[model samples]
Target: MTFENTKEFAQQLDSQDKLNKYRDEFIFPKVNGEKVIYFTGNSLGLQPKRTKAYVDEVMDDWANLAVEGHFYAEKPWWDYHERFAKPLSKIVGALPSEVTVMNTLTVNLHLLMVSFYRPTKSRYKIICEEKAFPSDQYMFQSQVHFHGYKTEDAIVEIKRREGEHNIRLEDVLAKIAEVGDELALVLIGGVNYYTGQVFDMKTITAAGHDAGAIVGWDLAHAAGNIKLELHDWNADFAAWCSYKYMNSGPGNASGCFVHEKHHNNPDLPRFAGWWGHNKERRFKMEPTFDPVQGADGWQISNLPILSLAPYLASVEMFEEIGMDALIEKRDRITAYLEFILQEIDKEVDSTFEIITPADPSERGCQLSVLLHGEGRSLFDYLMENGVITDWREPNVIRLAPVPLYCSFEDMYDFGQILKAGILR
Candidate 1:
């Protein structure tokens, strides 16, 4: 699809977009009575207009039904989290039994690691990309330390070539081979938060398994942003937050995946909670723990109905629109955004450099720009003008044109606003 760097061309594209109507489904941030051009879905997505009604439904149940709501209300609170499995499984490409929504992202990561990341004296090294999200880094370090290992000795970090922003897949594969017998786990982000680079999860998972290491992914940025096949990839486990591309409310309940191969394994170690006990005897409250079958076995507590409400609101939209439609628009709009930026670069002799991969398959909706000369000042200029974008530490500015809410015209207007900022 050839793109022209003009508002008329942008409008033409918007006129034909099937997902254009979804923009109205969300409530956008406004300034001076006008909606801001939101390009920060990688950080936090806009609230869906229906989120309020969904939350209120839960509130209404509590108001009238009181304790009886647990068993008798509409959509019984006892199995509230269960409904999410099927819809979220579609979003992340896993079986309903393989997926469950429960704790927040990091907590779920720790829980999964308890069952998957079994380290020993000879094979305990964890391989990951350098400068993974702070939480991930901390989790890795703490987990290794808990097992009487030093982080420096047990962690193998994959770094890029000196001038490159993204880690090459070859380098990642080689790290698995190099670590070989000592590599106990390979845990990395599916879509890097800072670079917006979508890692090859399938290839990476295979390589890690070949090296006799358990594999997992933190799909915080990738879950709803890219096409994932966690089950097909045979990933041991994975976790993701619902706030960003999932459009669930901020710090909402997160989702997790566990392959079916691990389902009936009674020997697998986990931090058991009453909620994860076998449903037949869960109310019996026996002294011994008998775990549930699939990913539901990892759950520690009953569903947080209020926090889970927004996810229901969001996943319904995902099921309605479907991922294929979402990915199609994502590719087109992101390419147009890249084209607009390049045109702006030519027009102004721009000093900014795109740090994300040029290949569409290697990225999601985000484009991380490295401002060479004037960095934060330019970011501030756009912010003051009401162009919402993400600014990472040091120098990267990320602009994500989410397919659900961002229009092609928004990208055009951004280019114009960027040109004005550069000229000023």
Candidate 2:
């Protein structure tokens, strides 16, 4: 399909768009009394308009039922988290029994590591992508330290080639082989936060297992943005935050996956709590920690229902639209965004190089643009002009044209605003 940098062309596309009407479901912030062209869904998703009803139900339940809400409320706070299992399983490509919602992303990762990241005297090294999200970096460092190993000796980072923007899959596989018997774990972000490259998890997980190591993914950017099959891929575990493409809220609850193979393994280690105990026997208050069979076994405490409410609202939206429809719109809109960028680059004196992979299968909604002859001033200009985008250090601007809310006209209008900013 051809794209044109014109309002009429954009509007024509919008008219034909099946998902365009869903944009009204979200509440967008205004700049200068007009709705801003939001490109930060990769950071914080716009709140769904229906979110209020979900939260209000919980708040009202608490007000009316008090302690009884745990047993008698509409959602039954005691079993509220059970609601996420089915819908979230579909989103992340896992069985309902293999998935659960718990604490936050990093916290869940840490808890999961207790079960998956076991290292022995000979096999102690962990392989991860270089420059992982800062939180993961800190977690890795701390985890190895707690196990009495230096980060330098225990963590092996897969580095991108000198001029390349993304890590090569071959390189990752080769690194896994090189680490070989010493490799205890292979964990990396499924979609890199910096370059927006989607890793091949199935192949990587298989490769890690062949090397006698456990494999997992941090799906912070991939969970709702791209296709995933944690179960089919045989990933030992995975976790992701709900605040990004999932659109839960700021620092909201997280979703997790634990393969079914590990469900019956009583020897698998994890931090236990009353919530993770078997549901029927939980009220018995037995001293033994007989954990719930699947992913719920990792839960450390009772869920925060208020946090899960917004998440439940969002996942239900995903269930309604389905991932197939979302991906169809995501690819087309992202391609159109890239086309707009290239068209504007041709007209302007500045050069805009897209650092993300050109293949649709290798990227999601984000396009990280590496600017030449441009800097933070351009980013500031865009924000002031009602274009809500993200600015990385040095000279890169990240734009995520989220399919649920952003429109085609936003790409055309952003081109106009961007051109003016460059000229100014």
Q: Pick the candidate with the highest lDDT.
A: 2
lDDT of 2 at 316: 97
Candidate 1 lDDT for residue 415 = 95
**238-274 per-residue lDDT for model 2 (tens digits):** 9999999999999999999999999999888888999
Structure candidate 2, residue pairs in collision: none
Candidate 1 stretches with Cα past 4 Å from truth are none
Per-structure clash totals for the candidates: 0, 0
Candidate 1 positional error at 23, Å = 0.4
Per-residue lDDT for 1-424 in model 1, tens only? 7889888999999999999999999998886677999998888999999999989989999999998999888888988888888888998999999999998999999999999889988999999998899999999989999999998999999999998899999999999999999999999999999999999999999999999999999999998889999999999999999999988988988999999999999889999899998977898989998888999989989879999999999998999999999999999999999999999999989678899999999999899998878778899999888899988889889998999999999999999999999989
All-Cα superposition RMSD per candidate: 0.8, 0.7
Worst 10 residues of 2 by lDDT: 344-353
